[model samples]
Target: MANDNKDFFERVYQVAELIPQGRVTSYGAIATYLGSSRSARMVGWALNKCSSWHRFIPAHRVVNRKGLLTGKHHFPGGETMKELLENEGVQVEDNQIVNFNEVFWDPSNELL
Candidate 1:
């Protein structure tokens, strides 16, 4: 069970790292790519603990299905997630990514 979780988290990191600059993906998207669409929330949980990871994971590039920055509060400083997205040239309004479909990056379609 521990090994399975470790592998799952590693897979999540790999997919999250694949996200291109100025693009974002959803927890559900990453979970789906990993063949665990039901584990979307788990994906977010794994990312929350990603600070301990040796490599830098662009966790800010992940959002909810509605393009909402649901995990923003999990960041150290307020607006950190928003700042990261804006830095990548992604427009954000009310904590929601504008033109979400345009910026959305799905690992399933992209990694193939």
Candidate 2:
């Protein structure tokens, strides 16, 4: 079980790292790209632990299905996630991304 969880987390990190600046994906999108559509929560869990990684993972580029910064609280500083996205030219307001679909990056489509 531990190995399985670790593998899942590693895959999550890989996908998170692949998220280009100025683009974002949802937890469900990453999970679905990994062939585990039901594991959206697991994707979020893996990203939550990403701070321990040696290299920086763009976990900030991930949001909920509704383009909501649901995991923002997990970041070290308040509004850090929002700041990161805005730095990448993704406008965020009221904790929700503006023009979400325009900035949404789908791994399943891009990686194909």
Candidate 3:
């Protein structure tokens, strides 16, 4: 069970790393890419525990399925994850993505 959890976290980070600098992906997307449609919560748990790796994982580029900045609390600035994303060229409004589909990065090909 421990090893399985570790593997899940590894894959979560792998998916997070694929999120482009100025773009974002949803937890469900990463879960689907990992072959589990119901693992979105697990993905969030993995990211929460691995906040130290934000430099490589781009954890700030992940939002909820509704495009809400649900994970903003994990950002270093505490309450400016959206601002950081904007600085990276991503447009955000009301703590939500303005054009999510336009900036979504598909990791299916890269993950395989």
TM-score for all models, in order of appearance = 0.97, 0.97, 0.86
Position 73, candidate 3: lDDT:
77
Model 1 C-alpha lDDT per residue in residues 54-101, reported as the tens digit of each score: 899999999999999999988999999999999999999999999899
Candidate 1's C-alpha lDDT? 0.95
The lDDT per prediction is 0.95, 0.95, 0.83
* lDDT (10s digit) by residue, model 2, range 4-78: 999999999999999999999999999999999999999999999989878899999999999999999999889
Query: Can you tell me which runs of candidate 1 are displaced by over 4 Å?
Result: none
* lDDT per residue as tens, model 3, 1-112: 3999889998889778877789888888899898988999998888887765545667888889888899887767756788878999988888889998888776765556
In candidate 3, list every pair of residues with a backbone clash: none
Q: How many steric overlaps are in each model, in order?
A: 0, 0, 0
Question: lDDT score, residue 103, model 3?
Answer: 81
Which window of 10 residues has the lowest lDDT sum in candidate 2? 47-56
Looking at model 1, the pairs that clash are none
Can you tell me which runs of candidate 3 are displaced by over 4 Å? Answer: 53-55, 109-112
